[model samples]
Target: MTEAPHNDPAEQTLRELESRVEALVQFCDRLQEENRLLRQENEQLRSERAVLSERGEQARIKVESMISRLRSMEQAS
Candidate 1:
């Protein structure tokens, strides 16, 4: 036969606390995983930004050189 459920106040409160703790532990684990993923993504973005910035600087230098050559030719003509 199935035993009757406990109606004790202290036991009920303890069970509730246990449930809350379990939920909190799960939530913390999820947050940690999410934080790890975000950090990885941030690092990748930083690397990409650095590469793009370098490329932009190179392009700017090339453009300036072209402009200087054009000015020189104009002045000679």
Candidate 2:
């Protein structure tokens, strides 16, 4: 196919395209940084939640044991 002529309009279009590409690159870089920080925060929160769940499970086991002991004592008395 034949190429289009490079007139004033083509030059203007190229400049606009360059400007848009630069803006998109900058935006993508910022978004990547933010996403990295969010992922780190998410990992940390997950770790904290895991620890809390373990503690809750321990507490539940302890409470159940205590309840069973109380029932046994009451039955004996």
Candidate 3:
């Protein structure tokens, strides 16, 4: 088998490729952690939103009832 030429450019390219792979692995790990945190935050926000929605509905009903009652009183006057 013939031996390939020892090119400096090829060696540099190999080094650059190895570094890129290492960086990619690190980036994947960081993204995974960030995704986990975001999921937890989303769950918390959903719970809070549900509670707020219920409270808003209750407030809306109360206001509607009050408006209805005021209209009847004014009509009676």
Better of 1 and 3 by TM-score: 1
Please estimate how well model 1 matches the true structure, expressed as its whole-model Cα lDDT. Answer: 0.97
lDDT of 1 by residue, 1-77 (tens): 97546877887998999999999999999999999999999999999999999999999999999999999999999
| Candidate 1 Cα outliers beyond 4 Å, as residue runs | 1-5
- Using Cα atoms with residue i matched to residue i, what is each candidate's TM-score against the true structure? 0.88, 0.84, 0.67
Of the two candidates 2 and 3, the one with more favorable lDDT, higher being better, is: 2
List candidate 2 segments past 4 Å from native. Answer: 1-7
For residues 1-77, could you state the per-residue lDDT of candidate 3 as single tens digits?
96656677887799899999999999999999999999999999999999999999999999999999999999999
Q: Can you write out model 2's per-residue Cα lDDT over 1-77, one digit (the tens) per residue?
A: 97667777988799899999999999999999999999999999999999999999999999999999999999999
In model 1, what are the clashing residue pairs, if there are any? none
As a whole number from 0 to 100, the lDDT of residue 35 in candidate 3 is 100
Which residue pairs show backbone clashes in model 3?
none
TM-score (C-alpha) between model 3 and the true structure = 0.67
Each candidate: what lDDT?
0.97, 0.97, 0.96
What root-mean-square deviation over C-alphas does model 3 reach? Answer: 3.9
| Clash list (residue pairs), candidate 2 | none
